[model samples]
Target: MDTMRDRFAPVVSQVLDEDPRVAVVLAEIGAADFQETARRHPDRVVNVGIREQLLVGAGAGLALTGMRPVLHTFASFLVERPFEQVKLDLGHQGLGAVLVSAAASFDWPAGGFTHMAPGDVALLDTLDGWTVHVPGHPDEAETLLRHAIAAGDDRVYVRLSLQANRAGHPVDGKRPLTVREGRSGVVVAVGPMLDAVLAATEGLDVSVLYTTTVRPFDTAALRRATASAGTDVVLVEPYLAGTSTAVVNDALADLPHRVLGLGVGRGELRRYGTLEEHVAAHGLDAGSLRERISAFLARRDAVPAAS
Candidate 1:
């Protein structure tokens, strides 16, 4: 199975071939992947060469000239380093571009903390009108990429990760897809976290909703899922823990709900380890997740019924 980043070049290359209006700006992160495409569309494919700020600014400039620009880089440099330009040049000026990032959280553990971006989504949440897609499979990433390119000058972020599920699910870039139904609670799994979430919830009485697109926050699907399965929600994300808990609270504001946000912890794990080791350390492995999720849900049994 190809990782999402592995599939990005081919998808973007195909898009560049078909769409003249589409342009790609790179910060020398994945330039080799698009060598052939750059040869064909030299004018549109640009490499800013390690200048993260210029990469975003150039993309915004292209957007200003009525060209749909797709910017690429590692998540840390793409979003965290050039965040000022992203806010002023793109958000403040109301320019739109598709900011595609590689290395989800700790995908490249060997690269150290500088390469990881566990807070990318949380940082983007500060800006408004940005559509974020966290695809769990390459096929879903391809679908979301096409959707973002055709979205008509909207601020979109496509977060590509090395982790992926065994199979791809049909994602429409709007709402969450219900994976399984149960009567006790709802588990909202985002992007590549679906497989572990499924394994953790096996034989457990909880509804699982899978989503590649998380920005719009499918309130309706979440509401419907909780309407039947009770109001306990566990958000299993591949990023910082409690990143989406605020949105979950707002979505279920009128009702009584308990939310357990599970993902990468806030504390820095100074040790550099393999990806699986990192996952286990962060309590994101299936065994750890099962323990956490079960314990959180078990608390509900101790609560007295409303009189």
Candidate 2:
């Protein structure tokens, strides 16, 4: 709560105060802290109370009436539960709003499988022109939210996960930020997984690129980074495994290179346990990731370089 989730309310509050066009639609999940915000602007802030469909529909309605709606809820309820609402009300209408989703992936494991939305970004891909930002820290979340509000009419999705990096990478909103330098390969850490990726690559000869914006792929930046670093790419995503593999493939289409994809598995694990246990079960723990990546790099090393 001290990290990503807690950072949202204050940003939304500031935006609501600063812009009359901004409206917040809640659905019982994030209604508590924002109750006063809703009360202050009775007509602008609304809590639809567990009705995710109504929640999205309300945001759409607000958008149609010339207001920019900022929708907030758990990832599952925001994207999966009311997917139709998102597809129709938001996408079909060609409306623009800021979608901030909490409890991303396996945040609250106790809430169980039903509470997770590991495929949210993949689903967003089905729609056209949506920019997805998976901020890895509270500071980045606040910065991204502020940017989204300031940018006006961007179909933006800010993914807030319980797992976080120690510090914000400070997105440029254009390209992936290269935080580390190397020569053999490039490891692209998407959002919250940066810390894990950093720890995993402790002694490896690989560059690390941190990005919050996933959509639009930032192919140019990726190509530049990868090409400069021997073109070996490893995408470490926090969501469903291989979600961004195709993009990476397309980005490096012209080159002969090796790539490794890692993230949460597609098949259901069907076991309830602590966060660390869940992470380990998915092979996302730092130690497991290090071993997997080490093996991948070793395979590339085994190949004979061009004579």
lDDT of 2: 0.85
Clashing pairs in 2: none
C-alpha TM-scores of all predictions: 0.97, 0.95
Tell me, by lDDT, which candidate is best: 1
lDDT of 1 at 97: 98
How big is the positional error of residue 156 in model 1, measured in Å on the Cα after superposition?
Answer: 0.5
Candidate 1 lDDT tens digits, 172-238: 9998999999999999999999999999999999999999988979888899999999999999999
Given candidate 1, what's the lDDT at residue 22?
A: 95
